[model samples]
Target chain A: MTGESLHLESVAGLVRGLAERRFSSEAVTRHFLDRIARLDARLNSIVTVTAETALDQAREADGRIARGQPRPLEGVPLLHKDIFCTQGVRTACGSRMLDNFVSPYDATVVSRLRAAGAVMLGKANMDEFAMGSSNETSFYGPVRNPWDTERVPGGSSGGSAAAVAARLTPAATGTDTGGSIRQPAALCGITGLKPTYGRVSRWGMIAFASSLDQAGPMAVSAEDCAHLLRAMAGFDERDSTSMNRPVPDYVAALEAPVDGLRVGLPREWFGEGLDAGVAEVVESAVAVLRELGAEVREVSLPHVGLSVPAYYVVAPAEASSNLARYDGVRFGYRCKDPRDLHDLYVRSRSEGFGAEVKRRILIGTYALSAGYYDAYYRKAQQIRRLIREDFLRAFETVDVLAGPTSPTPAFRIGERTRDPVSMYLSDVNTIAANLAGLPALSMPAGFTAGLPVGLQLVGRDFDEGRLLGVAHRFQQATDWHRRVPPGFE
Target chain B: MSLSDEQVSAIAELARLSVPRDALRGLAQELSAILDFVAQMNAVDTSGVEPMAHPQDVPQRLRPDEVTETIDRARYQAVAPAVSHGLYLVPRVIE
Candidate 1:
């Protein structure tokens, strides 16, 4: 097969082709590396391109294949969101704080994928410390939406989503604290999954919100996500929150019929603030599921409206604590000519962090401070319980909840950056899933005004198999996920 | 619900971050708006609701207290900004 055809192949197809030796792993890796070097300048999606390392790994993978010692994901080229710590590579997390810091150890997800024989292309760009909704906050630069270059790809997984949509790599790893994976996937016209909290290990992935952060897969289709997630998920002793449960055979689960599947449409998501164009696309997508013999019904998640407010408190509070480790003395950016230890801490943080990260740290500090702990932090946590209860209640009646992943399609860069509150609203439809600790994914539903819209499927805890299965069936019935961005093709 | 510049400065100090005096006014306004936005949580009656710290309600798992990792002191200190004789060097706290 030619390089052009290789770029168009899905993760599953690439794995099959590699196994069949139709194309050598080195050829596939070179095709993507060439694409990244030629095309990534326009998108600004990649932070670093590991061409030499990638080629070396590919050559090794070809040797493995020749010796008949291939692993499950042998020779698959993938990009990791810069948030995951890749030893010896710059894991910037899109922040200047760690711009010069090279990780000494690999994140559990990285090690697992490597053990399964996945090759790393490089780290993808992201919002600085995963704080922003749009990718504009990256210190490196904003990632352009492949569908419309002037627009965002959604973030903090914007780089990963754009790379996958542009076919620079077949799949990439993405972490979602609040819609980081799913929203970008929606805006960029790809598939991204945010597994239930604890379903995937968080051992070395940089933390934005300890309780909400989850690492998952972003790819061209749900089946591709399944293939990637199988290697990326499972319990790790290093992560206290990692659930000790057997990972279901996600690829096998994709073959399950969507017939008799119960999908709930949250009434709150479809009501006000939803763009009319996106609503039409999501509804039509649901109708396709209904046509495939799935039952649809309206469900109430009344507390979801408060999720954005609660998330701001909870996420920032945890971030304030998690980010405290970046005190300039160890592992990250430090200031020069400090008069005292106090000066070192203050100036290093002030200079190292960007505006949004500072804003969150201050908010969290105030919330957890002496006078306001109960009013802000505790109250948000209490409201968090209400949100989780809402999902649990909905799940009692439906196998999964389906809705628009984002309230609108990819907005123009610099559109909402000035208004922090407006940027926070970009995740309004998706934040509740993270708060509820449920499995959620965004798959290409259809397009609106030439831009892709995502239909989000949220499932019960550890129910990623069902979410992927449902989305796989939807892709089979609709041509949405297969539609590539024009220039990339 | 708006925060004063003094309050913003105080919060920054608490967080161990330095905010230039000129930036405090704008920072205060932005933070106040976020605080105002999040204050909507007060509308709900959460009187008896338990605060959920983690999604998985599982208790923290503990393993046998043993040395599971080799001491890779050199590797761990490779990224430190300043070091002297294998110890991370920071500005002295006291004379």
Candidate 2:
């Protein structure tokens, strides 16, 4: 196969290509690495390109194929978001604190993918410590949107989204605390899924918010995401919160018909704050689902408006506690000199964390502090229950909720950096799903003013198969997912 | 609801993070804005609502009292900034 065709192939296509011996794993891996070398400078999507290690893994996969011992993902090259700990490789998590900290072990997601024979093509950049809405917070640099270089790629999975959108890699792993995976996938015109809170093990993935974080796949199509999710999700004893349920074959579930499916459009999602262009695109996508014999209706989720505010409080409160481990003690960064442990702790953290991270830590500390805990932290948790209840009420009547994934398409870089509240609102539509711990995904709907728009589908907890099946059917009806970025082609 | 610079300093101290004197003013303004934004939650009455911590209501799973694996102290400490005699080195506390 030509290099152009090689880069354009989906994860499933690449798997088949390797199995059929149409292209060797080494050739495929080399093709992607070469693309990153030539194109990534424009996007700043990758933090590290593990060329040597990837070639080694690809060669091993080829040997296995030669011996008729092929594995599930056998030789498919993919990038992991820097948040996942890659054994013996620098897993920076887009922060200066861990820039020098090479992980001693692989994250559960990483280990599972490796077990499935997927080749790692280095780590993708992200918002520092997975905190920001745009990729601008990365200690490395911002990951630019492939569609327009001046615009931002929604983050903290921005790098993974950009990499997959540009075809630099066939697939990449992304973790969503509050819309990290789906928001970026929306802005960058790719497919991303955030499984139910406990669906994927978070044993080695760095904690942003313990209750909210989930790792999922970002790829060009839902079919590809299904193939990757089958390899990535399952119960693990290490993560106490990991759900003990049988892993469903997501790929096989994609064949289920969307006929007679119930899709609800939350009235709150279509109200103010949703860009008109994005709403129109989402409505058109819903029309396609309706034509496929699915039932569509407007559902009320009144409490969802408070999701952003509640999320801001709850996530930061958890983050402050989780990040306290970064003091100048064990691993990570340390200050040059210190008068005492107090100075060491303060100075090391002040120096290591970025502005956005520090702001969150302060907010979290104040919220969880002695006198204000009930007003902020506890109040947010109560509001969280209300938000979850709203979704539960909606799900009682509908199998899935469909809407616009992001409020707008990719905004210009530095657009909302000065106003932190504005930045927080970018996640308004997607945060409720995380709060509810439901399965949700974003797929390319169409383009608006030369930029791509995404249609989001959310489902009841552990109903990822239904969400993927719905998205797969949509992609079949439209060519939006197949549309590559301008210069990327 | 706006936080003063002094309050910001107190919160920073509580979090064990040092903020430069110049950055404190701007930081205080940002924090105050965020607080005002989140204060919108107070408008609704959550009189009997239980605070949800975990998304799923699952009881903590207890494991048998057995060592899962041997400790690799050296391998774990390899990433530490300072280590001496198999222990992590820190500023002298008692001194």
Candidate 3:
């Protein structure tokens, strides 16, 4: 098969081609690496391209397939967001602090995918330390949306979403703390899943917010996401918060019928902040579910409006603690010269961190500070319980919640850069899922103007299998996920 | 609560980050605005709520006391900014 045919092939399709020797894995890997070299300069979606290692892995995969012994995901090429540490590869986390840092250990997600015979194309860029809603905050430079080069791809997994949408590789890994994966996947018009927290091990995935952070897949379709998630999800003893439950056969679960699935549409999601075009697109997507013989109902997650504000407090508070390890004396960037220990600590951090990261650190430090802990951190945690309870209550009536993944589709690159509040509000529809540690998937609903709108489906904890089944059936009925950008096509 | 410049600086110091002289005022203003937004939680009565630190509320798993890792000092220190005589070289803290 030629490079264009390979690029358009889904993960399942690529695996079949490899098994049938239609094309060698090395050829597939080269096709994507060549595309990254030729086209990534325009999108700025990649940080490091591991051409030699990828070629080496691809050759090994070809050997496995030729020997009639192959792993489930053998020979599929994919990119990992820079946040996951790939041993001996630069794991910058899209920050200047770790710009020169090469990890000595592979993240569990990276190693697991490698064991499954997946070849890593490269490390995709992201918002600095996974802190921003738009890709504009990356130290490497903003990742331009493939849909419109002038617009953002949505972040902090913006690069991953863009790469998958443009078919730079079949799939990529993305982490969602506060809508990083789902929001970007929606804006870029691809299938992205943020599995329930603890569903996937967090070992060696750089921590942004421990409680809310989850590693999952971004791919061209829900079927592809199901295959990738099957390989990526499992318990690990290394990650303290990793759940000990057995991972369900996600790919097998995708075939389950959604004939009587109860879909919930939270009234709060359609309130003031939602764009009219986005709401219309999401409703039409719901109508597709209705056509699938699923019952859709209006449910109330009354505390949903507080998601952004509560997320800002809780996420940053945990981030301050998680990011404190980058103190310059250890690994990461340091100031050229330091006057004293205090100066070393302060100057190294100030010089190394970007504006958004520093702002979050300061806010987190203040929230966790002695006198203000109850008012900020504790109260935010209490709000988190209320949000979780709201989901619990709604789940009693519905199997899953559906809404717009983002308030609007892709905005211009620099539109919300100066105003942090506005950027925080963009995550309104998606943050509640992260807060409740629920599984959420964002798939292309339709287009608004010229950009894609994402219809988000959120499932109860550990119910990702059911969520994927519903998404897979919807995808079978619609063609939105098949649409590619004008230039990318 | 809105923060003053001094308060912002104090928070920065505690967090071990330095705020540049010119940027302090802007940082303070931005942080205060964020704090005001987060203050919306105060309106909710969390009178009998338990603060959630982890999603699952699972207890921290403990293992048998044992040395699980071998010391690879060279590899560990390879990414450090400054190291000398098998020690990380930091500015002198004591006179």
On residues A1-489, what C-alpha lDDT tens digit does candidate 3 reach at each position?
A: 576668998999999999999999999999988888888988999999999999999999999999999999998899999999998999999899999899989999999999999999999999999999989889999999999999999999999999999889899999999899999999999999999999999999999999899999999999999999999999898998889899999989999988898989899988887889998999899999999999999999988878889999999999999989988998999998899888888888998999999999999999999998888888888999999999999999999999999989899989998889999988989999999899999999999998999999999889999988899999999999999998787
The digit string of per-residue lDDT tens for model 1 on A1-489 reads 676779999889988999899999999999999999999999999999999999999999999999999998999999999999999999999999999989999999999999999999999999999988889989998999999999999999999999999999999999999999999999999999999999889999999999899999999999999999999999999999889999999999999999999999999999888999999999899999999999999999989999999999999999999999999997799999999999999999989999899999999999899989999999999999999999999989999999999999999999999999999999998999999899999999999999999999999989999999999999999988888899888
What pairs collide in candidate 1? none
CA lDDT, candidate 2, residue A320: 98
lDDT of each: 0.94, 0.94, 0.92
Q: What is the lDDT of residue A437 in candidate 1?
A: 92
Which portions of model 2 miss their true places by more than 4 Å?
none
Error of 2 at A434 (Å): 0.8
| Candidate 3: residue A82 Cα off by (Å) | 0.5
Sort by DockQ, top down from the best: 1, 2, 3
Recovery fraction of native interface contacts for candidate 3: 0.82
Candidate 3's displacement at residue A391, Å, is 0.3
Model 2 residue A462 lDDT? 97
